[model samples]
Target: MTQALSQTRTGGPALPQERRLVTDIPGPRSTELLARKKAAVADGVGTTLPVFVEAAGGGVIVDADGNSLIDLGSGIAVVSVGNAAPGVVRAVTEQVAAFTHTCFMVTPYAGYVEVCEALAELTPGDHAKKSALFNSGAEAVENAVKIARVATGRDAVGVFDHAYHGRTNLTMAMTAKNMPYKNGFGPFASEIYRAPMSYPFRDGLSGEEAAARAIDHLDKQVGVANLACIAIEPILGEGGFIEPAPGFLPALAAWAKDNGVLFIADEIQSGFCRTGAWFAVDDEGVIPDLVTTAKGIAGGLPLAGVTGRAEIMDSVHVGGLGGTYGGNPVACAAALGSIAEMKEHRLDARALEIGTLIRGRLEKLAAEHAVIADIRGRGAMQAIELCAPGTKDPDAARAAAVSAYCHKSGVVTLTCGTWGNVFRFLPPLVISDALLEEAFDVVAEAFAATA
Candidate 1:
């Protein structure tokens, strides 16, 4: 490695390359563990692959079966600060040594309050805001809806198609994709409705057209007046990294205001500088009444938060929103350190840097491959969609093959999209340029070989 990258502190190509496997992916040891997992783990816990990991550090994940894999997926965008980041490790270690859980709602702790204060200061908007922490992103989303409904005294909550809010009963109802997430899980929460999202790749509709279509639907079908809140992922995550068109999000925000509806931006996957901004909604300079965050918020730790207007947040009665382990000391400590690392390292700029590199490389690949239909995303949260050339139908098989190829080659990637044709890249913002370029090289080779 070059001296510059070798000595660097954060993500770029300065990191080490991952080692490929000489044996089957689930080589001996992993096979043994998989068998044990089958007996001990619940069936509901699903994994994309059978690779069993021993340890993960920096931008690489080492499997128990003796394979070191590049982590382009970053635990599905949860570890943007990197795996085993020094800051996170130090904070978590110190916090765990002192105390693990105190039940913030019961006894409270400095760490929890400190994290909330940090969120109040860090999340988008200059207005006075308050925060309520949760154990997962879905809980934060669910609470945001509840708070909005109670504040507005309206029962109807509007969500967009292709959105993946969470798997909880209410979130399942709010989510747009039905197959895997909502399939066989029914009797979902009520008062939830789906609106058309602005997906430029397959939809072929302009921002104005998409927003107009959705607005017309609301006006004619549901009537926005009955809506309490309109929740959306500023950059749709599982629905594909589909960024709202130029006029789409802004128009929706304006309409929400006009119709007395609260706007909630679910920044679970795209927030905390992953999109080259604190939150994706800030790109449009639109202020959401409520902002839901998780994933990268606490590095790899499980911590979710909902930050919004102080008045609206206070509207909820005491004990109405909170959890026992929502902001555990360990999670809060990790969050504090993660935020500090983000600012000190300028991860926002790093995200833009990574975005440019990946986009350029993927654009070249798209030009050469007929199946590569579109390249879209913002900052480090980028994705490529596959299609049967000349047709809008999804090519999920090709996407899956590409993912498997990447896995075998020692680079870990993920697939998303309602149609399952999009390959998403969620590398940690702290990854080195060298490691990133190397991973991209593997991805390109995978596509070339498959082609």
Candidate 2:
């Protein structure tokens, strides 16, 4: 690290933005907590890293043992405004003191309405829009499907290969992976169909060709008349940070409009400035009929929303939507604050800067390491797919080894992909360029050591 890269406090956190290790990762306190967690928590609740966090902000998470680890995962892309962001903190504090919850469905609140208005203004399309808030990405997705089905009077919903919607029964059926997300959980919901995705690295097809193939499959397998909506992540997230080839999304959107099918953009993990745009679909000028958002929307609070054309969103019966905790007052406040922070800071531009730095570093690493089969994604949401040295065979073992190396070295990295051969990077947008370079240096070392 250079003197110019010296640590400086950012994100208004109490701790300085620096990586410090006083003990081994998952050190004494975290290990003890792990033991307690094992005894009290369910075995199914898996963790990427064993270290238990005491506090986190900017780009570092402080563990119980005083180890300050660089945060590259951003709690699975949920804290893009940075953990404990000042705006979120202040809004949440005031809201909590005023009132916790009267239930939005019962009495409603200004925060919830304000958040809906923000979503309407921010999401793609100049047409009149409406929004319904939910508690998670899954809830938003499920609701979007419900709205589409009601509006179109169609039963079938289409998803793409390598897609991951959520853990709910309906979303599980829509998800492509079967291991942990689907496994024994089914019997799942009906009328859920799967289609091919535009994965440029693997398929080697042009965007227009790939979209044609997907449309062909849907038309043959599930007729357009029967399909309610074709939901997709503008940039695939859990399935790997796969950005569909250029022109692919626009083609699909055109097809959906030609037919009566609703084009639902699942922006759960890629929205809120994480992808250098308000939403990934904006890159290709694809205006989706329905857009689902979560993860980074509320700093770290649980809030999700489905925003779309006014008529379609209002198609569903008044009481047909909503849950007990869908738009909790506190979460709504956090969403307001989070959106304020994003607009004030222009984190979208910051994401572009961070992406340029990280992608450039990874490109250099890829040039050196044959194990890096592909490097892809936009803004802070980037990833490298690990493969055998001489072939395109997925090398999940190498990915695992590198992740372990990162964990031991006190960098909180994450891995994802259908085959588990992808090392994804989702650093907080608030992360400084110097810190990002430091994290990439650690990543480079891991690749070299593992190789």
Candidate 3:
């Protein structure tokens, strides 16, 4: 018997939690909008799916053509509390009515201070902490580097292989993938160095060994004295939900601490109960000097933050870190509401339930499909890497085919990886178990059809 799951709890704009295809995948309305987008929008701004969304809530996104699709990607992990979550909607509505932006620099507000307090309480650290808000993950990352540089008085920044930081010049240098994020963007910021990551599936190395490899590279390429920080995603997001080997992070963090280098955890995609924890680094108890967050931070509002030790955060000059829209009053309210929702509903625990169900289904699919090279991740941030049947040779073609199949069937799935052979699932934490199981069935069918 199929086990029944509870309904999604998004209180506002309740959408029927079912996948419905009224027209073709890209329906006539979507096709028409695509033509307009091509004419009005820049060719550089690419979209994963061309289907224009009219409304979304709970576990689904409703397109302009009246098709309801299961949301597996969560808008790249932005709307984890669900689109139009009641708390977020109410908070945003009230905040907008009261005031929009006061340029926190010119005039401060309680919302910004309240958010910082929340961050200090939620992030993995018991010590004194402070935060500075920004508008995007890229800006937060850039600012974190600035804080690290000033605090440590070092110039070189170290990152790892298969990392995706951001699109800005410095973060592009920090990022590892080259084709889309860094093709023509040349002469990136200097003093940015890359090291090998702890990819057990590919490297076949133990966590300690992987840490040694990265440390050796950093020691040889960028000396500890010159290194300001070692920034990394606890679970690589666009690099394919790759979780570093068990001991890799701890070893690296220890080395960084010993050498006076700051450890920066870029939890932009993996934070906020998406990984069954407030922050992914909590799994290993690796406390970082600085943590950069966005995506799920403000329940879809444009807000990001850098939370770190008070001394390190305060080292920068008073005027050094303030943006016109940084810590916008409305975004801060949404963040507060989002945090309240996470705690009130215990979405962290929900993430674990979601992960167990997803991992179980994907494991069953892997048993039947030889192309599934690996299944790995924590909580709702899971992925299946596609590869040649018997060996680990990445098969980007198969990944693309499976993704195309899911899209055609009205399931919004996403593909990622440095090799482009990973099919990732980032379902909203509020998604129903039944919906997840149904989506997994579609994924299984996609794999079988491709096979």
Candidate 4:
């Protein structure tokens, strides 16, 4: 919370990949900008850390105050290939120079088609798949529901507890969180039901048992005939990186098949090598009927898509789907560049390496911290749920304190989950071991000081 006069961007230091705090947290320049933002920006739009980012690369962000903070939150799981990645930069610059937009719905271009092709090729399953591009994860999820309803002629959608689909009206109805997401903004869309998730730490039910309970609940409550789709995040993202028990996803996918309901895997937060694989469901060999993707899909550009069985995706009327700026050419090109970076660097394996390293470090932290109730998630997308010592009561305050401590120490961290007690880490895949270890060192210091 310390501050001094704002520093000017005299194009300082070479933007190194290390954590360098040249000023206090939210230094003078950032404070001034924060003042401007408060004056001009809507109160509804809140910032996690108010330090204005001047530049970011690799695993660090350079703030206006010339502070380099180790980025443990990769812009909320985007920029997996790193900020200003060579390929993404090249593609974006080239596309910008060539043309900006023609509206894909009007004079469709190759970039959109190419991105769709990539989705089909990379998404789970060898079955004939087709894709439709969108502007965000919410759009992809919403469109997946539309495709499923049109294909099945059903009105009901089954979502899970601790789910975070999006903030759109229809998605708000589908989402389980209430406070910030749906609190007063309800009278939401109808026929969206919630099923219990297979949370081993909290429920302690076997994967099969939890899946059975969820299936039975949906069957008895919603009736299979009326269910258009069952949407879920394979590795629950905003719900604290909660990875469903091993058999949960497969069982749900199977039930969806038996019930003629489309199984939609919302990979918005866990896809694109974030979970040590192309998709989190891949760990259990669960091939969803429809998979929605965004976040890391287009480097940092806004791009998302729903890739599913050809028939289901094509069942909708040609004109029924699409938006004015759904698949911007610049975004599509960025996706291409991002995909190239992923392939060339084999980031899938890199994610696994990061998972192992982070999981190990977190395990050590948990061993010393009684507040760590659960250590979960996969790959670079990991989290530690905080609770009162020796009890299951979520310690949101402790989580917030630890996060704040990290923030002030020049380490960017994030907290998530329905209870706001899950401290999650999503470092860029390209981060170096030195930086990662140093970030964890800072986290360890935060824990000791907070304790």
Cα deviation at 311, candidate 4, in Å, is 0.5
Candidate 2 C-alpha error for residue 82, in Å: 0.6
TM-score of each: 0.96, 0.98, 0.98, 0.97
The ten-residue window of minimal lDDT in model 3 covers: 1-10
Superposed model 3: Cα runs more than 4 Å off? 1-8
Instruction: Give the higher-lDDT candidate: 1 or 3.
Output: 3
Candidate 3 lDDT at 137 equals 97
Q: What does candidate 3 score on TM?
A: 0.98
Better of 1 and 4 by TM-score: 4
The residue-by-residue lDDT of candidate 2 on 1-451, one tens digit each, is 2222223224453677877889988899999999999999999999989999888888889999999999999999999988888889999999999999998889988988999999999999999999999999999999999999999999999999999999999999999998889998889999999999999999999999999999999999999999999999998998988889999999999999999999999999999999899899999899999999999999999999999999998899879999989889999999999999899888899899889999999999999999999999998899999989878799999999999999999899999999999989999888877778888889989999998
- Candidate 1 on 137-235: residue-level lDDT in tens? 999999999999889999998899899999999999999888889999999998898889998875778878898999898777787778999999999
Candidate 4 — which pairs collide?
6-28, 6-29
Q: CA lDDT of each candidate?
A: 0.86, 0.91, 0.93, 0.90
Model 2's C-alpha root-mean-square deviation from the true structure amounts to 1.9
Kindly state the number of residue pairs that clash in model 4. 2
Off by over 4 Å in 1: 1-17, 20-22
lDDT at 212, model 3? 97
Local accuracy of candidate 3 as per-residue lDDT tens digits, 342-372: 8988999999999999999999998998999
Question: How far out, in Å, is residue 242 in model 1?
Answer: 1.1
Best by lDDT: 3
